[model samples]
Target: MKKQNQKAWFFVLPVLLLVAFNALIPMMTVVNYSVQETFGNNLFFWEGLGWFEKLLRSERFHAALGRQFMFTGMILAIEVPLGVIIALSMPRSGFWVPVCLVLMALPMLIPWNVVGAMWNIFTLPDIGLLGYLMNHVLGIDYNMTQDPFAAWATIIVMDVWHWTSLVVLLSYAGLVSIPEAYYQAARIDGASNWSVFRHIQLPKMKQVLTIAILLRFMDSFNIYTEPFVLTGGGPGNATTLLSIDLVKIALGQFDLGPAAAMSLIYFVITLFVSWLFYTLMTKDDE
Candidate 1:
């Protein structure tokens, strides 16, 4: 039997310490707060799992979670297919490839809050470009501030604009990684474009697609800053996602115990859904 080198653990010690300080410590603190009620000057009282029970039965929590899921679902439905199509349409090898990649990357490079702020201004009915196009140039009633549907649509479009590039870039990478031999074989067999894509490209892209879906799911589910800045969960709670609700509980209402409980529940839901996505995507292989 070969003896594994224990010295490698020393090399990883710094990362472990960093994780403990950043993640583990905060998580432990939240766990403590979840079970304990707090008052002024760091005073605390035992609350047990009462907060958790309260949140579990809260209508507000249920509504926020439903909205979050709907937003994420719409994002996935729109962004994934749109991204794959964009990637597929892109040149496989050419001077335009880098330019396309750069353009796709531009939205993602913008700061999250900045993206929100930019959209907020850009959707102003009087002066903004999109708002002008919709309201004046197209003769449409496009007020996100007043209409719940409009507000939801605006946030969805804003998120898709901001993050679809991630899926495009990932799918593009998967597309470009295909060997020339596969194409040659397909050509030799007189395979149709759809056939080639269905048989060759689809399988090749599955791994990356899985990654894209998981990433988008997690990020969209946990999203806060952008939507908050853009809509403030507004048009009468039309876009108030679970994260925003969590923030309201934690900071707005100063209900630390319930907030902490809600945080843990949110964390678990995200983890569970992400795991389910990964498992279902990969199950076919095994």
Candidate 2:
């Protein structure tokens, strides 16, 4: 047993080294930059806690953080249940299973920028199917460029379309992996559909649901490209998430110190929340 456990470490060692080189080194550099002020030509001055303090008090940061949380919460709430329902409705044993899975996976395979650009063209009010139907047929002002609510709605809908497939796939995997014996036993006991699902399917799916929730939360919280390409963080600052605002500060405004500090804070918050989610999701098992 000891030798087998020791052999497993060899498989993990390469990955650990790669992560250290690629992720940890860059992260430490960012931490260093976050604490120092730099002038042009490689001049740096100690400015410990200054940038962090400023970001903590900044109204823009507060607003962006609030919007980020709201978007992530809304996404998880909507996607999780919807994905589960879709998964449950899908055929359990059929030749169509592979076809359905491939179709579901298609969206997630597209490049992020392409997804954004495609949506941009597809939502044009003149030629776009959705835009024309919503604005003209429904008699609603649905232009994302001019209206804040419209912009928000478009972004949310686009995100749901893009990412709900991930949850669906994961849930479907969990559902399919459940042994037929469990269903047989449930049937023998005269279990109703709801009871079987509640007692067996839902519990078995907890791990995958936890993965879906964490992935969606982190992705939504850190979302930038789609919204940036779609709205450029605005028709005003209505869609400026924390990640977008951080990029704006770092590149657009050349505020490296503050942006670095904010990035560190962003990383910390994500890590903390993810750990909490893992704990909560796994606690019942113990």
Candidate 3:
């Protein structure tokens, strides 16, 4: 019998300890807060499931959750197909590949808060370039602050601009990994472009696309900063996603029990939906 190496356990132990400290401890603290009401410093009262029950029945929670779903659904619908199309259009080789990749990655390189602030300034009705163009040159009423429709459009557009690049990069990676022999074989068989894509490209890219969909879904569902900075959840709660609403409850209203319950609920929903997506997408493989 050969002796197994035990030294690797030492390397993994520190990471496990770090995760327990950072994630597990905080999670336990949230769980504690969820079941108990805090009146002030060192004062707590058991609330049991009251907060969870209340939140489940709350209209505000429902509305925010609905908006979150809508946002995530729209993001996945737009980004996945657009990313694939952009990837397909990209050059397989030569001078433009690096340039195009860099450009696609540029939006993603910016910090999330900066992206929000940048768009906020870029869409100001008076001084902003796009705003001026729409209002003056194009003669359009495009104030996101006052109009719900405009607000939705602006946030959606902003998200697409910022995140579609992730999908594009993933799709491009999938595309480039395809062996040239597949194309050669397709040509030998006189396969049409559509046929080639359907039979070869789409199948090969399915895994990456699945990854892209899940990532976009989670990010869009939990998104807070950009939309908050851009619309402040108004004109009147038009874009108050669940995360934003959770923060409003936790910080703004200072409701610890309810906020903790909502946080747990939000986390569970995300985890369950992501699992569902992954299972459905990969079921055919199994």
Candidate 4:
């Protein structure tokens, strides 16, 4: 029998330690906070799962969660298909390949907070480009700050603009990675475009699309910075996502116990749903 090298762990030790220090430690802190009540002077008392129970029953929590799911669902529905379409439209190989990729990548390159701020300014009623185009040029009463529908539409559109490129890039990678022989064979078999895509391209892209879906789901689900900056959970709680609500409880109301519980719950929901997605996507493979 060949002996495995035990020395490989030495190279990976630092990374493990780093993860523990950064992720594990903070997680432990959150876990601690979730079960305890804290006042001032770093004092804490045992509260058990009271906060969790309270939040579970709270109508406010339910509304925030529902809104969050709705937003996430909307973006996923829009970004995935739109991304695939855009990716399919892109040149397979040419001088425009790099140019197209660069353009697609521009939105993602901007920081999240900056993206939110940019969109907020871009959609402002008075001096903003989009707002001006809609109100003045198009003669539409499109004010996101005051209109709930407008606010929702703006956030959804902003997210789609920012993140759909990610899906496009991933899908393109999957598409380009497919063996040229597959296309040639499909052509020889007199395969239709729809048939070629349905069988050859889609099956090949499954892994990447699965990855894309998982990434988009998690990111959209946990999203805070952009929408918070763009909407501030307002037009009066019209778009208060789960993360925003958690922040409000933790920071605004100084309700540490409830906030901590909500965060843990939030974490579990994200983990479970991501796991569920992965499992469902990969089940046939297994």
RMSD per model, one decimal: 2.2, 3.5, 2.5, 2.6
Candidate topping lDDT:
4
lDDT of 4 by residue, 17-97 (tens): 999999999999999999999999999999998889999999999999999999999999999999999999999998999
Candidate 1 lands at a TM-score of 0.95
lDDT per residue for candidate 3 within 1-286, as digits (tens), equals: 9999999999999999999999999999999999999987779999999999999999999999999999999988999999999999999999999999999999999988898889888888888888888998899988989999999999999999999999999999999999999999999999999999999999999999999989998888889889988888888999888988999999999999999999999999999999999999999997
User: What is the Å distance of residue 40 in model 1 from its true position?
Assistant: 1.2
Error of 1 at 193 (Å): 1.3
Q: Each prediction's TM-score against the native?
A: 0.95, 0.92, 0.95, 0.95
The per-candidate count of clashes, in order, stands at: 0, 0, 0, 0
Candidate 1 weakest ten by summed lDDT: 230-239
| Candidates by lDDT, descending order | 4, 1, 3, 2
How big is the positional error of residue 159 in model 3, measured in Å on the Cα after superposition?
A: 0.4
Cα deviation at 238, candidate 1, in Å, is: 0.7
- Candidate 3 Cα outliers beyond 4 Å, as residue runs: 1-12
For model 2, how big is the CA root-mean-square deviation?
Answer: 3.5
